[model samples]
Structures are given as structure tokens and as C-alpha cells.
Target: MKKGFRFLLKTIMWFMVITFAFVVLFKWVPVPVTPLMVIRYFEQDSEKRTFWKHDWESIDNISKNLQLAVICSEDQNFLNHNGFDIEAIEKAFEYNKKGKRVRGGSTISQQTAKNVFLWPQRSWLRKGLETYFTFLIEVIWSKERIMEVYLNSIEMGKGVYGAEAAAQYWFKKPAARLTQYEAAAIAAVLPSPQRYKASPASPYIQGRKAWIVKQMHFYGPFSYDKK
Candidate 1:
């Protein structure tokens, strides 16, 4: 029992050490790829050739409109939270408990952690690791860096990843050049990137885009400069 306990302790210690180093390394480096990207590629039909598109753009190069649009559409408290938004979590929990459609309360920071360090499946272990990585990133990375990595790594459409790639894929323009409505359209499809179109929108995507644009207006002009 003593030997087994020591082995478990040592294993956990090594895991923490390695993961911490990994997170710190990514603080400055661009994330090359994500687990979700790989998983999605394999999930495609093997009979047909599959394509993957991703381009890394610095936070400065990505449009402020897109940054703000995602904040409005996904996490309004993104700028204020310490990696978690308690109120949103509570609401999602209550809503799910009431037998309504399930919703996620993840903050942008939390989503960044999962996208950068973990997989896409919804297991308790994955959730726990996501929380752990989220704390690590919030401690080691700046808000701008977190947003940069998030914008550069998240899946935006089928075979499309990141703001840069999504911009070109959907609008035939670079990420830095996307307009407010264009950015909102991209953000509107985030809830189900693979299932929805970011351009030539269906009625559902158009309505979501309108709502997100309204929210972005209320959010006002956005800047990542520290106040």
C-alpha cells in the first residue's frame, strides 16, 4: 500500500510539472494545432479526401469587431471573469436541471484552455482537466494572449479553424478586414460551427447574426488595451 501510494503521488507530481511547462511554453508560442482539429479530421468520411484550414493571426491582426462579437455572442463577462463566470454557470445548471435544452456556461478563458490543451468530448475527467488548464492559463497568460490563442484555435466552420481561415473561407477576405456584420455572422455560427453556414446564411443564422450585432452595438467600441 505504501509503495502504491508513493507511485501514485509521483505520477501526479510529474503530470503537474509537465503540464505546467507546456502551458507556460504556449503562453508566448502560437498553438500549432489542437486536439479538436485532429479529431474532426478523422471523423470525416474516410472515402473522401478531407481538408483542414487554419491560419494563425496575432491578436493585433484579427479584427476588434470579431473579438467583440464573440464576447457578446458567447461570454459577456469575458473581460471581468477569472476564467469562470459563476452566474452563467448557475443559470445553465438550473436551466439544464429543469429539463430544458442543455447549455454551457464556459467563459472565454475556459474555452481557450479546452481548445488549446484538451479534447472535445464531455466527460467529467475532461471537465476537471479543463478547469485545471483554465486556471493555469489565467495565471500565466494575459487577457490579450488568451484571446489571441482562442481566436486562432477555435473551430469556425466545417474544415475551417480560426478567425483568419474562417474569414477567407466565408467572406473571401482576411480576418483583419472583416466588417462588423461579417464578424457577427461568423460569431453567430460558433455555437454549431460545423452545422451552420457563416455566409449565404439560412434564416436561422441570419436571425442569430442580427441578435449578435445588436449585442455588439450595446457592447460598444472594444479595445484590448489594459486600462
Candidate 2:
């Protein structure tokens, strides 16, 4: 029993060291691929119907409006939070308990952690692992680095990942050149990108885009350098 405990301790220690090193390495390096990208590629449907769109443009290559728009739409307090938004998480918990509707309280940091290191599914194990990885990145990576990875890694449409890909496919331009409204339009579809079009004006997207623009005006020019 003592030998078994020793083995477990050693194994866990090795995992922490390895994962910590991996996370730190990514702080300076671009992530070539992520777990979700791999899963999306292998989903039999992806080959038959959906073609993946992804290009890793640095955060500096993406527009400032887009940065503000996503922050406004996804996590209003993204710059302020550590890895989790405690108030939002608490609200989500209470909202779920009432069974009124289902809502997610995942902060941008948590979503980045999930997209980068974890798989597509919700389980206690996944959530536990997400929390662990989120804390690690928050400690090791800057807020700009966190946003850079999130914007460049998240799924924008059926198989699209990152700002450059989304801009090219939707707006026929580079991410650096997207207009404020164009950026907001892209941000608006993020909650259900597959369901909503960022162009050609779906009524749902039109309404959300307007709202996101208002939010951007309120959020007012957040460059990640602030953090």
C-alpha cells in the first residue's frame, strides 16, 4: 500500500511538472493545434460537409475593435478577472437551480483552457481539469496572452477557428481590416456561430450585432495591453 501511494505521488508530481512546462512554453509560442480542432476534424460530418477554416494570426494582426467586441460580448470583465468570474459563475449556478433555462458562466479564460487543453464534453472530470488548467494559465500567462489564445483558438462557425479565418470567410478581408460593425457582427454570432450568419443579416444576428455594438461603445476601446 505504501509503495502504491509512492507511485501515485510520483506520477502526479511528474504530471504537474510536465503540464506546467507545456503551458509556459505556449506563452511564447503559437499553438499549432488544439483538442477541439482535432475533434472537429475527425467528426465524420466535418469531412462530408464542413471544411475547417483556421489561420493563426497574432493578436496584433487582429483589429482592436474585434478585441473589444469579443470582450464585450463574451466576458465583460475579462480584463479584470483572474481565471474565473465569480459573480457570473454564481449567477449561473442560481439560474440553473431554478430550471428556468440553461446558461453557461464560463469566462474567456476557462473557455481558452478548455479549447486548448481539454476535450469537447461536460463532465465533473473535465470541469475539474479546466479549473486546474485555467488557474495555471492565469498565473503563468498575461491577460493579453490569454485573449490572444482565446481569439485564435475558439470555434467561430461550423469548423472555423480564429479571427483571421473568420474575417476572410465572412467579410472578405483580413482580421486587421474588419470594421467596428463588421467586428461586432462576428462577435454577435459567437454564442451559436453555426446557427447564425455573421453576414447576409439574419434577424437574430442583426439584433445581437446591434446590441454588441452598443456594448462595444460602452466598453470603449479595450486593447489587451491595459492588463
Q: For candidate 2, lDDT tens digit of each residue in 1-227?
A: 99999999999999899999989999999888898878877874644855578899888899988888888889999998888999999999999999887889999999999999999699999999999999999999999999899889888877889999999989999999999899999998888877888988689888989999999888786655565
Error of 2 at 204 (Å): 1.1
* Residue 114 miss distance in model 1 (angstroms): 0.9
Candidate 1: stretches off by over 4 Å = 225-227
For each of the candidates, the C-alpha root-mean-square deviation to the true structure, in angstroms, is: 1.2, 1.7
| Backbone collision tally, model 1 | 0
Give candidate 2 regions above 4 Å deviation. 46-51, 223-227
CA shift of 185, model 1, Å: 0.5
What lDDT score belongs to each candidate, Candidate 1 first?
0.92, 0.89
User: Any residue pairs clashing in model 2, and if so which?
Assistant: none
Best by TM-score: 1
* Top lDDT model: 1
Per-candidate TM vs. native? 0.97, 0.94
